[model samples]
Target: MTELREAAPSAGTDLLDERTRELADYCAAMTGRLRVIGQRLDRDPDAITEFLHEPQVRFPVQGMLPPQYRSAGEFPAPLVAASSTVLGQVVATEQVAYGDPNVILASPGPSLSGGVVQALADEQQRQRYFGRLAAAPTHTFFALTEPAKGSAALELETTLTPAPGGGWLLNGAKCYIGNGARAQLGVVFCRRAPGPWGIEAVLLDTSAPGFSGELLPTVGLRGARISRLRFQDVAVAPEDLLGADRSPSRRGLYGATYILYRFRPGIAAMALGCAQAACDYLRTHRATLPRQDRHRLDGVLDRIAAVRHRTYAVAAAVDAGVVDVAGIGAVKARAARVAEDATRLVAELLGPASLIEHPWLEKTYRDVRAFELMEGTTNLHTMAAFQSLLRSRTALQPAAQRAVDGAARH
Candidate 1:
C-alpha cells in the first residue's frame, strides 16, 4: 500500500493546488493566447474552415517532443492540464468550437492510439508509429463508432480477415469519426465475427490504397472535419494489430474502456468551459434584463457554478490518481447537461438576437449538444454510475455478507 501510494505521485500533481501557482499561471498565459487565436478564427469564415483541416491548429507540433523524449510510459498529468486548458479557452471564446473535434482529436485522439500501440505493439512497432507525431504535425484518429453500431461499439461490423500472405484485410465503414478525413494515421476497430474477443483494433495509414473518406457535414462543430470512412480490403500489417497480432485480446473492449476513462474528464472540462462561458456572457448582460429575469439568471449561474466545481473536483482526483472510472462518466454527463442547459437559457435571454445576430451563442448551442453524445452518451454514463453505486453498496453491506456466510456454514 505504501509503495503504491509512493508510485502514484509519479503520474502528476494537481495544478490547481496553491503550491503549483507557477504551473497555473503558465496554463493561464497559454489559454489567453488560445483565446486570441480563437477570436481571430471566428472572424474569418474561410480561415476557420481551413483551420479545421490544419493539423497544427488543433494539435500544435510545438507541444510534441523529439524522439529522445518519447517513451512508452504512463500519460503525463501536464498533458491533461494543458489539453483541458486549451479546450476550455477555445470553448470559452465560443469561436469554432475547436475543442470538440480538434482537441478531442488532438489530445485523446493520439493518446488512445499511443496507449494501444504501447500496450500491444512491439518496441519497433511503437517507435515507427509513435515517431510520426514528433517527425511533423501529424493527425491521428481513433475510429470506433459506425453509423449503426455507435451504441454497440463493441459489436463491430467491420471485418478483418487474414490476408493471403502476411496482413489482415479490412472491410467496412466508420462514421462520425473526428479528424477522420484529415488524419494521416488511425486505429480502426473491427471484428472477426461478433462476440467479445472478435472485437479488435488495427492501426492503418489513411493514405493506404483501398481506403476512402468523405467528410460528414455537421450542424455544430463545422470545423471538426468528421468523416465517414470506407475500407475496401484495406490491408493492415500483422504488427498493426492492437494488443496482439493474429489473435484478439480475450478481455474484450478493455483498451477502449481505458481510453475513455483517461480522456473523458478532460472532455467534461471542455463542456464545463462552455457552460462557464455562457454564464459569463449572461452575467455581463444581466443588468440589462428585467428584475424578474435577474432571479432566473442567478439560479442558472448557481447551477453552472456547481457543475464547474464538480468538474474541477473530478480533474483533481484524476491528477491525484484516485478517480473512479465511473465517476468520469458521471462528471461528463453532468457537465454536458449543464452546458446544454446554460446555453439554452442564454439563448432564451438573448431571444432571436442570439440565433440571428450573434454567432457565438448560436454556435455554442449546437456545439454543446455534441457533448452529450461524445466520449460517452448520457445513457451510457447513467448505467456506469448506477453500476458503480451498486458496487459501492455491496462493498458496504457487511451485515448482509455475514448473514450469507452464516447460512453457508449452517
Candidate 2:
C-alpha cells in the first residue's frame, strides 16, 4: 500500500484513468480473436484441453503482454495498472464466455504467472523471462497450490533438497496449476527445510528432466489446461532460485503474497464481467417480466454496479499503495458473491427457458460459479477477511466495519 500511494491517485473520483482506458482499448481490439476461440470451443467443449498446443492461438493471448505490462514509470502504479488491464482482459473473456465459457481460461494463465515473475524475480531474471514475452508469445505457470494443502499455500509439502552435486533436487507435486501442463517455465514454491522460514521459491524450466503433467478434468473453464505437475528429482541450477538471495526466509512468502494481492483484484474483475454480462442480457430480454420480477432486476443491476465500482476502488487502492492482503480478499470475496448472485438472478429471470434456450446464459452461470472457487474459495477468503478486520484497530472506522460485515456470511 505504501508503494501504491506514491504511484497512483487517492481513491476518489476519476477512477477511469489513462491506464484503464488503454486496457479497454486493448481488450476491444482483441475481441475478435477471442470470439474465434469461443467459436472453436462451442464446437468442442474440451477444446481448451488441446488449444494451448497451437502457436497461432496461444501467441495472440501471450502477445498481449506487451501492452498490458508496459511500464507506468512508478513503483506500484505500473503493477496496479497492469493488474487493472488484466481485469479488463478477464472482462473481455467473460464477455466472450457469454458465447463459450471455455475461452476465458486461456488469458488468465499468463497474467497470473507473470505476476509471480514480476514479484519474485531479480532484474536480470525479469528481463530474461519477460523479454521473451515482449518479443514473442511465451507461457508460464505459477506453481504453489497442492492437492493435499489446497488454498493453504504455506502448508506446501513440496521439498527442495540440496543436490548431490551442487544445485537442487525438487521432488513433489502441484495441483490445479493454471498453466501447469503446457507452460515453458514455472515458479515452484517449495519448503527449503522443515519450518516457516524454510519456505522458498524457484523458477524451473518445465521442460527439464523429470518434470511432467496431465490435464485434469474440470466442470468449467474447460479451455484452460489446468493440471497437476509432478517434479521427480527435477534438477535446477542455483541461478534458478527466485528473489536472488531472498529465498529460504519469510521473504519468499511475502513476495508470493504480494503477487496474490495484486492479482486477486483482477479475478474480482473477471467475476464482474460475468455479472455485467448477465445484467445486460437480463435487462434486454426480461423486459416483459412481472412487476415484482422487474423490481428484483433493478436490485440486481444496482448490486452489480456497486460490486463493479468497489472492484475499481480496490484497483485504485492498489495503485495508491493502500490496499492490504485482507482488503484484496474482501474485494474478491464480495465480487465473487456478487457475480454468482447476478448470474443466478439472470437464470431465474428466464423462468424455465433457462434450461432450453440461451446457451450463453447457461455457460456463464456455470463459469461464474468457478470464480468463487478459484484463487481461493469464498468461505476461506470470507473468514480470512473477517478475521483481519477483527484485528485491525481501524475496524471502528465506517469503511472497515462495512468490509467486516460484507465478508461474513456473504
Top candidate on lDDT is 2
Cα displacement (angstroms), candidate 1, residue 308, comes to 3.0
Model 1 Cα lDDT, one tens digit per residue, 295-376: 7777776775565555556656655667676777887898789888888888888776766765656666776788887887
lDDT of 2 by residue, 94-210 (tens): 334333345655543355666677667777777777776655445578888999998586698999899999999999999988767877877888887766777778887778999
By summed lDDT, the worst window of 10 consecutive residues in model 1 runs over: 1-10
TM-score of each: 0.77, 0.79
Q: In model 1, how large is the Cα lDDT of residue 314?
A: 63
List per-prediction Cα lDDT, in the order shown. Answer: 0.61, 0.66
Q: Residue 82: error of model 2 in Å?
A: 7.0
Clashes (N, CA, C under 3 Å) per candidate: 0, 7
Candidate 1 residue pairs that clash:
none
Which segments of model 1 are wrong by more than 4 Å? 1-15, 18-24, 30-111, 245-252, 287-291, 319-323, 394-398, 401-410
| Clash number for candidate 2 | 7
Please give the lDDT score for candidate 1: 0.61
